[model samples]
Every structure is written in structure tokens, then in C-alpha cells.
Target: MPGVKATALSAAILVSAARAEPLKVGGIDLDTPPSHCAPLRDAEVPKAATLGFVSGAMTASAVYWIHREQRRRRQPGKATHPREWAIWTRLDRKKKGYVTRKDLKSLCYRFESDEHAEHLAKQLDPWGMDHINFSSFINNFKVVQMMRQAGRLKLWHRCCGLGVAGNVAGHMAQAGEAGQESHSATKPAAIFSYYMPPHPYQVSDQQADKKRLQEFPVTYAVIDYPKLPGACKVQVEPELGLLVDIVYTKDRKRVDHLVPRRVAAFNDCSIRSLEGAEKLSMKKNWGFGSKGISLRSFPVDGFGPGTFVDFLALVSYMKRDGEVFQYSVKAPVRNYLLFHEPLLEWIVEQINGQKDTDKWEEIFPQLAASDFPTSSWIALGAGEYTDYGATHFLQPLDEVVVVVYDERVMPDGPGMAQVLEMFEDTPAPAGSVMLHQTFV
Candidate 1:
């Protein structure tokens, strides 16, 4: 009470009074009407009277109480409507927090509710606004039937690259040399694992004589070059990631069908110099944002032959010391040995039976533990790295960029020539999934 202001005390009293069944104002009961001796019984001093008649204390108290009530109503948890929260979480992944007309349009398409997209947009952007602050939008509107199911949706990562391209043999050799094992039996492999950030067992202050486990060095969209044991060298593997719908059989409970929903730019970012590591995923999983994927994605239906993704190519760039250089081969998706249905088939097989090797492990047992996740991050391998990107390792302050876009949508021109022309442009073109990760 020593430092408490009179107005603050008055507001606190008013809020306390609000909780009771019969409200009392300044010790005057409202439920029993007014007593003859009540201070405000016959007069409208606080409500209708001007400054001349009302005491300064009373006026200030009224103003403070109203302000406090409005503030309380606007608090985040209570204020954010359920439907708005649903739309926010859905958009949070795709839009990365900001919502615009274009974003809403895409969301509508994803949810198959385009008819209500404009209406919802109007609610968030009444005056035809541009980007709606995610918080403001969620606090204002409620959407029906748009709630995604509640569950701890595990994010599964599927790394691809058996023998497609990008110097598969060369990588295998490097892996074998690091692990001191023969490379002859090495085959294409995939890992079905989710990222786990640093746990109590993973981190410690006292440096051990052996090797220290690397932790996830970042939290947001940016990737960090983690300091690891055994002369570590980190590199970015530019790959295309897919979000799929899994179909499971009742009796088997295994993933029977894989339907790719969306495709986006992904950096299957990894560690290159691991000494005698048993599993490939050991070098892969460091923590949250250890890998980079674009929040924006293109539907997969139009991505097959003669489709959008068929004409699309994956490109990568690395920026160092104000200079940007091509980091990986701009390869077309169709060029990949296995793609579309075939790629899906290969992934399922790899999950079920691919044998483990020194360089990589099949992780079938791991998948089984997670109940064979239907949804996963399918990384379809990185393209050929540039001579410089291949040799040079990632360092702090370095920027890695990966983009996926359609060449068919480009201005009419020759086949591969148009793609080359498109890649030569300084910045990534529109309608492209450009994932940017700043290492540090």
C-alpha cells in the first residue's frame, strides 16, 4: 500500500466487487437498490455529471476500471477465439506467422474451402488490407470446421539418395573412409527419424575426454554450424522435401499407400566429418531448425510429368563475404531415377527392408517404434554440389539458399536453355519455394 496509487487501488476494488453476486460500489449495495443515505443514491454524479460536480477521485476511478476491464478482455489466451487459433496454427506453418490475401487463398485451396477464403480475409482485412498480423487476425475471427485434429504430430524425416546422382559413390567413399570400413557394400539408404533438441543427457558443462555430443544450435528458421566432436565439417545438402498423406491397412497397420501432398525446398543439411558414427542420423539430428525447409509449398498434383514440378528444377546458392555462388546442380525433378509413384514405392521398401551399412542405416526398427508414421519429410537427395561447395565446409555467417520452381511457367523458350537462363537470374524467381538458412 505504500507505493500504490489511489486510482490503482480503486480499480482493484472494482474488479473484486465484479466477482460477487450482489455488487457493491464504495460500500453502497446495488442488489438492494439504493439506501437514502447512499453517497450516489439519487444523483448521477459519476455517470452523467461533468467535471464540475464529480470528484476527481471518482472520475479517475471510473476511467481506470473501464481501461482495466478492456485490457483484461484483450488478454491473449482468453481473447483468441478457438476458430481463429485454428486458422492461426494452420497458417503459422505455411505463412510463418504473417497472413496475406495470397496466403489466405493458398490456405483455402489446401483446406478445400476457397468459398470462405475471401469472407475470412474480409474479417481479418476489412479494408482490403495486405498482411494481417497473425495475432490480430486470430484474436478477431472464428472459423468453423477448420480445426485440425489434436495430437503430438511427429515430424518424420526421410533422406533419399541411394544411387541417383550427385556423386553417390564419392559420398559413400568419404563415409567409409571416415568410419574405417569398406565401401563396396554401400547402397542407397534412408533414415526414418525425427529431430530431438538437446536433452538432459545430451548436454553438459564439464568437457569429457572422449567426444562431446553436438546440440541443436538454433531455434528459429536459421541454421547454425554446430561445433561437434571429431574434427567436424558441416555442409548443406540441397534437396526437395515432400509432405505426404499415408494410407494404412487395418490388419497390417503398416503404411500401405503414400500420397505426396506438397513439395518445397529443403536443405538436408548435414555433418560431413563424423568418425566411426554408427547411424547416419546421428550426424543429422542436432536440434530444432538444424534442417531447413520452406514454409511455402506447391501442391504435388501438378508436379508430375507435364505437370508443374516436372518443369521445375532445384537450385542452390551459397553467399560468403558478399559474394553469392551457385552451390549445387540445377537438376530437374524428372531426371531423378525414382520419382512420383516409383519414388514413393522405393521409400516404403527402404523403410521396411533396406539393410543397414557403415555409411547409413535403414532405421526400420525406429520407424516401427513410431508406429510407421504416415506423414513425413521426404528429402529426395541433394543435387551435385559445385566444386567449391563440395570442397568447402559451412562456417558461421555463411548463407545457404535452396529453391524449387517451375520452368514451364517461364516465358516461352528452348527446353533446358530456359532453365539455365532462369537460374542465371540474381534472385530466385516468383512461384518458387526458396528456403534461406543463415549459418551461425
Candidate 2:
């Protein structure tokens, strides 16, 4: 009887401990939001054969353990649950820190039919890389979660723009972007304010909002022409913008994850003259209405081949004195040097690794000091400008329009005549996202 009582007491203590600790998968606490999880530590690279064998054994063990635990704690009418991390680990057969299209397809087939799984695989691997690292995996996971959780708009303020990613020959020289040629395409060239919706607390605490407003200022939402100060030349840098969710480390020293949710047309309007500018950001944020993004944006279901993003193309036009002409070269979004998943991966690296040297400023430290915003609107890169766009600075009443549209709607690309028709048409062309701004 004493032995039985002792056993009962031990069981009670074990149950108490289990209840106290949160469920964890792959050393990550599931109870905590994914955004708050600590950055994944570097793991030792395992030899191929050994990695395959060990990973296979570990995956099998984990599956069995999870199922056994679930059955023991099962409640009536409850469905069996498997964590996302578990699925990722199982698919990473070689434990190579990434998963291939084949792995994704195989797993997807379980819930989706074979045809659907194949389609999903294509959507997941839009860049045709055939494999995706953990960052991309988590990004896709978060995208799904966002789609499911509707109503609340993700809060974001800053817009990070990438320079030289245009890869258009001689564009830097033409734009007179000094030191831009030396900067790597993978890194962000400048940061500007895009959105700063007043917080409820700001109603009572006006000073807090004022301080932030003074720093970032209002650079986006250009409805009218931008007021150019002094003898400055302004030009539109037509680019694709991605609205993404940013997840930083608990300490906020580093970016832990990025979830790209939407794609839109962006104008990284810039001052032609450097004048007193020492850094790229100095020329970027001139004041209110200095930059622009299309009011209409398309949701990014996935980054891969058959997804919504894959069909998109970018083109810009300028209307001056009642005449419309192509401003930036008509190019598909896929034409950028770094795009889709690769671009997202590069952004993560730059956010965490880019240093303050020469014309570039350190971004991570700034984000950390600024209360770690949960989201950002990133301008991937500008497209190469046509002769007219490069040579002509905005005169009073000049109209700039940047469009991101589905190329499948016009497979062979549109002619100048068709483009002009689009420019003149009211309510914009179907299947297109447009950002139109006129200079005063």
C-alpha cells in the first residue's frame, strides 16, 4: 500500500511538470509566437550518408513518440495534430537544413491529392530552385497563417529599398547615384517611411507620435506632385514592392523571420542631385508625398512558378503635355537579379549582416532602437529607365505612372500603342496594379 501511494505521488508530480512546461518541437517553444522564438543556432554540417541515416531514424522516432503522446492525451472527437516543424524535419531527409520540391510534394500528397500536391510544389518553388531553406519554409508557413487569421492589418512603418538590383546596364550612372555601383545588389540602399497610422495611445500622448513623425516623416502616399525644394531634379524609380511581416529576435538585435504577403507597384522617387547627401537615405526621404505605392496590391499565395506573383510584370509610363510615353523598360518581375525566394533570403542576410560603412547605414541597430516594428514594405529594386525617363526631370504637371500587371493577360508583351491606350483608359486596365502621381 505504501509502495502504491509512492507511485501515485510520483505520477502526480510528473503530470504537474508536464502541465507547467509548454509543448516544444525541434527545441522551439510552441506556446510562444513564432516571431518571439530565439534565432536558430548554427548546427554542425553532417556528412551526407550519416545525415540521411540519422535523420531518418530521428524522424521515425519523433513521429512514433508524437503519436503515442497524442493518443494518451486524446479527447473525444479531437483530430490528430502534427506540428509544422515536425513536417519540415521529416521532409528534410538529409538534414541538410533545406527541403527539395520532391519532399514537399510527397508530404503535400497526404492531405492534398497528387495533382494538387504537384501544383503546390510548383507554387512553393517559384524560382525553380527545387529546394528551399528553413527561412523560406517558415515564411510560407506564416503566409498561410496570415491568410487564415483575417481582419487585423499587420503594422509596418518603414520601407527598405534595394539599389543596383535593377541590373540594368548603366542605370546607376544615368541616375547619378554616386557610390551606388560599388554597393552590392543584395543589400538595401535606403530606408524611408511608408505608413505611420497614429496609435490609440498617441491621442493622449501627442509627443510620442511627434518625435517619431519628425524622424521618419511622411514619405509615402503621394496623391499630388511632390514639392521639390531649391534647384533639385526628381525622377521616378519604378520598382516592385513587397509587404512583409518582420520577426525579430527577443533581444531585437537580429531579424529572425520574414513573411512576404503582398506585391504592389512602387515608386522610389529620388532626387537627382546628391548636393549635401553623404548616404543613400539622405536623398530618399525628402518629405511628405516623396514616394508612392499602388493602392491596389495582389496577395502572394506563393513565390513559385504557378503562383500569382509568377505572372506579374512591371512597366512604367510618363504623360507630359498630353502625350504618353514609356518611362521605364517593360520587364517581368522575374527579370531582377535577385527575386522571389532568393530575394527574400538575401533581404534577411542584409538586414542582419549589413554594416554602416561609406554610403550605407546600419539597419538592424536602427530597427532595434525604434521599438522593433512588426512589418515593412520593401521596394525590391527599380527597373531600367527609358531615354525619356532618364533624361527628363519632372516639370510641373508631369504625370508618372508605374504598373505591375499579370503578363499572362498579354503574353507577348504589349506594344507602345497598347501601352498608350492603357494610359488613357479610365479606371486602369484589368489585371493591373497602378501607382500614378503627378508633380506640382
Candidate 3:
């Protein structure tokens, strides 16, 4: 068997190949690529509902009859959708298209109601045709996963990637996974935490006793100084954020699928010390911008392939006393503590089985009640801290900057070998996704 590094390369190539063309699995050949064409004109579709109803019924009848006649005229086996256009081209006897909304519901691996199916059909049929155009459809839908409603980031259960908190102990434990061997006795792991925004009112017994939890106020972004509570020490945890799509059974009691779609630079910032802290979340949330994430993101197309994310690197800096200090070691996302498909499966298992303890909070009940959250944003984990970052805490008038950039896009020359090489004297470069925040 190939070593982990070789296996990773093989997996990446497989993922890239799957993305490049129609996929066939389990001995089933898929549909041929669709022809390129502009969306159908508005004039081709009836405007009024009455006209549409009548036309739709007539069109259905005509299509059904024509399809039946065609099937009768063709040879027995040839009546099926052409082998080249196999799965993508499931010629519906009634719908008059290769694929329909019902087919999409099954193929996409998510179950939906009638209304949801119609909504998907409307989005896919840009020209008002009920059928989807496979090529254009793949270009738009396959790359990104969106939530039905913009879910409150507060609703999200913020999970912290741990096992990187200290220098010698944490580093030694996780080093082999970072090096070529990729196997380890002490596996790096993640812990669950949650944020509670400051609110004036007290939690009443009526609210706490209810089956559904009350919604908390959400602060998704901040550009200025954040209000630090009391005199607690605070530090930023620079990491990458992964947005995942989760599907659940109709009963909403259990999760069926969990897939990552987009990756963005993230700051899993936290307080240095908290009194009687049971879970890490107590250190995580304080107020608006308590956590930081870049406004920009890239899709994880075949995540292992690195086609979309490998070029990126994470670096953070602190501006204090009129001078800038590198606050965290520059690390690539691929060098993260845990990643790829094994990590993905591990996370799903963690959510389902993790129990409430003196040091960790239970996640299974929260997830089940939230219907497995159609979406989740997860921080990959933090990297090695700089000397200054390890010693100093946030003080008033200090500035913190975190950036994620495509190192592959770094310009050539003696001064520009890497992003850090260009960071000595100048401000952050143009293409990097940067977040600059000040302490108040």
C-alpha cells in the first residue's frame, strides 16, 4: 500500500478527475455533457398563470405522447436515455426532459418537500423551462452550498481545533502528522464550545425549560475596536474556517451527510483566562467581532486536490508601539492538525457522540434540536504562536491583523520569495484577505 503522502496525491488526482467531467460510479455511466446555449427567452414562456396552466397541461400531454411514440419507434434497448448522457439524461416520459426536479432530489442526496423541489426547479431553470441544463447547472450549483436562510452565526456551535495550545508538548504530539509520516500515537483532536452574547435580561425558568432554545443576538463582523469585558486577557487564534453542508433525516433526529464546501481564513480568538471555565466556549465569545473570519472565501472543489485551497497560507501580525510583530508562525492550511476525509468523518462522529463533561459541552442534543443545522462554519485549528504572541495579551490601542493569501501568487524576486519575505516593511499585499482590528 502507498504511504499517506502518496495516498494523498492519488486521492487529489481522483477528486480532480471527478470534478472535470460527468462521473460514473458502481458500473453506471452518466449522462454526456450538455450543449451550451443562452437561457430561453421570456417570450417563449406564458406570462399569466391561467395561460401557463393551460399551456403546461397541453405541453405535458404533447410531450408524453411524443415520447411514447418515439419509444415505440426505437429498438427495445435504444429507447433509454443515450449511454453518453446516462444519469444526467434520464428522459422522463412525462416531463419531456432528461432530468426533472424529482430526479434532482435523489441525485443531490438531500430529501425535500414539494415546495422545496419546485424552488430548486425554478433556480435551475433560468429560462423558465422546468428541466435543468447539466453543464450550466454544474457550474453554478456544484461548487457552492448555500443555506435556505442566512443562519445566525450565533446558532452555530463553534468548535475549536485543539492540541496546539502549548509549544513543546503539543508540538511533539502533533509533529509526525505534520511531517511526511502522517501517522501518530497521540492524534490531534477538536473540542466543542459555544458563544453567549452579553444580554441585559436574565434567563427565566420559562425560557430555559422549553424544548426549543431561545435565539441569541448575532454579531458576524466587526471593523473597529471591540468592547473587552472586565480586565480579562484576550488573544487571537488564527486558523482557517470551513463551511459545511449537513443533511438530516426527515424526522430531524439524526444527520445523514456532512460535507465541506468553502474555506475562509478565520480567527478563533479567545480569552486567555476565565474563572471556573467548564468548556472552551467560555473563553471564545464576548461581543461583536469576538471571532474573526475573512469576508472572502474559496470553494473546496475536491478538497484534497488542493486545486482551490492549497496555494493559501495563514499569517497574523500585531501592531504595537509603532512597530509590527509577526504574531503567529506562517503555516499552510494543508499543514493543519487534522484534515481531508478522515477528519470529516471524525467530526460527524464527534458531534453525534460527544457528551457534556466538566471540560466539554454536549453537542448531540443541540444538533438534533437544530435539525442538524443545514450549515456550519468550523475553525480548522491554530498554528504555532510567536514569542510576542505567547507573552503578550491584548492591550488598549493595540492593532491585530490576520491574513490568508495565495502564496502561489506571490511575485518573483530576491525580496519576494514568500509572503513573509515581503511583510518586513510594507503593509499587507493587494490579493490577501486581511482583517485588521484594534483593542479598545
Q: What TM-score would each prediction reach against the true structure? A: 0.53, 0.56, 0.51
lDDT of 3 by residue, 258-316 (tens): 67787766777766666655455555655444666654567776566556666777878
Off by over 4 Å in 2: 1-169, 178-231, 412-425
Q: How good is model 3 by TM-score?
A: 0.51
Please list the Cα RMSD from the true structure of every candidate, rounded to 1 decimal place.
14.8, 27.1, 27.9
Q: Residue-wise lDDT of candidate 1 within 397-426, one digit each (tens)?
A: 666678787766543212333333322322
lDDT of 1 at 37: 57
Please give the lDDT score for candidate 3. 0.53
- Candidate 2 vs. true structure, TM-score: 0.56
Model 3 per-residue lDDT at 180: 31
Q: Under the 3 Å rule for N, CA and C atoms, how many clashes does model 2 have?
A: 2
Clashes of each: 1, 2, 5
Task: Give the per-residue lDDT of model 2 (tens digit) for 144-217.
Answer: 23221221122233333333333444456567764556234543343333334343233455555443223332
Name the weakest run of 10 consecutive residues (lDDT summed) in model 2: 146-155
- Candidate 1 at 52: error in angstroms? 57
Which scores greater on TM-score, model 1 or model 3?
A: 1
